[model samples]
Target: MTTLVYLETHDGELTNGGLGLLSKAASLGGGDVAGVVLGSGVRDAAASAGAFGASTVYVVEDEALAAPLPQPRVDALEAVVKESGAENVFLPASVLAADVAAGLAARLDAGLNWDLTDLRLEDGELVGLRPALGDTVLVDVGWTSTPRLALVRSGTFDPVESGGTAEVKEVAASFQEFSTQARLVDHLQEESSGPSIEDADVIVAGGRGLGGPDGFSICEELAAALGGAVAATRAVVDAGWYPYAAQVGQTGKTVSPRLYIALGISGAIQHKVGMQGSGTIVAVNKDPNAPIFDFADLGVVGDLTQIAPKLTELLRARK
Candidate 1:
């Protein structure tokens, strides 16, 4: 089987999620593992895919695809898939990638299994594992048609370098008038310091027990001390206490940081499903009976207002 992993780059670099997926796709070891990069000036970034396990890197560089729009990418990806005859297509979940994946599925009349957390080859067939029933259970999913498409959840895997090189191949793409009809008007990025939640190695997350919008300062200070990023629960984002981009839960971004510290979080199932994959989970809450304690590797029954500052100060002093 020939597998194609869509490599998405941002700010002239391949996204960690996309590289991680490419690494995982290479590990399956059943077929030729190739990565397709679609964007203007993405050739340089595509070269790094070889180190992450791509045996071949397909580059589709077009000026019209400069912006982070989805339709042009769909067109480019379709051309690459057709030319390469890729039987399995994998993409890391992102706002634009999700749109392009859906568009490609419709264009090719293929089956798409999205929100997949894991995938494996069994009996020479690909199987996708996804959360079902509100993420309460894991169910196996597969495509009945050729060119099986799968969208992997963000932070589901980490990139590992294989010290290999890829043969770079350039491909041409044709865009439909309708696909190029929409033009990007403007792009506004969220101004943030430190790592983004999805890419952060350490994340200090806040929840409703934080009391008010201003309470995020506590998480910010601690996260800063640890050289990490601040995250929030759906409750805090819904209450306008934090930006929706920083929310981590069932409806929000999934993060698998090396260390996840929760402040005043109740550990609801919705929140658990997102960050449960963290390497180490630490919860700080005043209530001993809080559900967060059940799964936290280290549980501290204390007031975050009192503990957070002290922890930050101690970390600063040690630094």
Candidate 2:
């Protein structure tokens, strides 16, 4: 089987999620693993995929793809898929990627399995693992047709450098007239000081137990002291206590950081499904029987208003 990974680039650099998926495809060890980069002036980023284990990198650099639109990307990817004869296509879930994946699937008449958390080869067939029943169970999923498509959750895998080189192949850019009709007017980047929650090694998340929007100050202080990013629960975001981008839950983004600290979180099943992949989980809440304590590596029953400030001070002092 030949696998093609869609390498998404941001700010002229390949995203970690895309590189991680490329690394995983290489580790699967079933066939030739290649990557497709679609954008203007992305040759350097395309070549960099070699470090993550892509043996072949397909480049479709065109002025039409200068904007982060889905249709042009779908066109570029379709050309590469036909030229490369890739039987399987993998994409890391993102706003643009999700749209491109759906468009490509429809164009190719292929089966797409979305929200997959894990994948493995069993008896020479690929199997995808999907969470069901509010993430309480994992079910196996597969495609019945050729040229299978899959969209995996973010932060599901870590990229490993293989110390290898890739053969860069350039593909001709051809787009449908309708694909280029849309024009990008304005692009705004979110202003943030620290790493995003998806890329942060450590995350400190706040919840409704914080009592109000002002209570997130403790979370911010602690997160800053630890050199981590601040996150929030759906309840806090829905209540207008936090930004929706910082929310973590079933309807939000999934993250797998090295350390996850929950402050005043009740650990609903919706929230647990988002960060269950963290390496170490620590929960601090006033309720001794809070659901967060059930799976936390360390549980502290205390008032976050009092304990968080002390913890932040201790962490700053140690630094």
Candidate 3:
């Protein structure tokens, strides 16, 4: 089975999530794993794909594809799929990649399995593991036909560099008139301190138990002491206690940090499903019987208002 992993780049750097998916696909050892990159001036990022395990990298670089839009990428990816004759197409879940994957599925009339957390070769067939019943059960999903499309959940896999090289081939652009109609007007970036949750090794997340918007300062202080980032649950984001960009839950971004510090979080299923992949989970709550205590590697029964500041001070003193 020939696999094609969509490699998405931002600011000339390959996104870690896409690279992780590419690495996972290559690990299957089923057949040749190729990568498809589409963006203007992205030639430099193709080599990084090889380091993650792509045997070949197909690039479609053009001025029209420079913007982070979906239509142009969909057109470019469809062309590569046909040229490479890829039986399986995989993409890391992103706001833009999701649209591109959906467009490709419609263009090729292929089955699309989305929100997959894992994939494996079972009995010579590709099986995708997806969460069902509100993430209570893991269901095995498969495509009935060739040219299967899958959108893997973010932070599902870690990219392992093998120091390998890839054969880079530039594919010709085949853009339709309508595909290039939409153009990016302006991009507004959210201002935040410290590392982003996606890249942070440690994340300190707060929930409704934080009391109010001011309570986030406790999380921020702890995150700063740890040289990490601050995250929040959907409840706080919807309540305007935190920015949506920092929200961590089923409706928000998935993060797999080395250490996850949850303060005042009840560990509802929606929030647990997102951070369950963390290496070590530590929860600080006043309730000893909080649901988070059931899964957290370390549970501290206390009021975060008193505990968080002290923890931050201890970390600072150690430094």
lDDT of each: 0.93, 0.93, 0.93
Q: Please, what's the RMSD in Å of model 2?
A: 1.3
Error of 2 at 128 (Å): 0.7
Instruction: Provide the lDDT at 312 for model 1.
Output: 96
lDDT of 3 by residue, 1-319 (tens): 7899998897789998999999999999999999999988999998779998999999999998988899989889988999899999999999899999999999999999999999999988999999988888999999999899999998788899988999999999789999989989998988787899999999999999999999999999999999999999999999999998888877788899999999999999989988988999999999998999999999999999999999999999999
> Candidate 2's error at 286, in angstroms?
1.2
> Could you tell me which residue pairs clash in candidate 2?
none
Runs of candidate 1 exceeding 4 Å displacement: none
Q: What local lDDT score does residue 158 receive in model 3, on the 0 to 100 scale?
A: 88
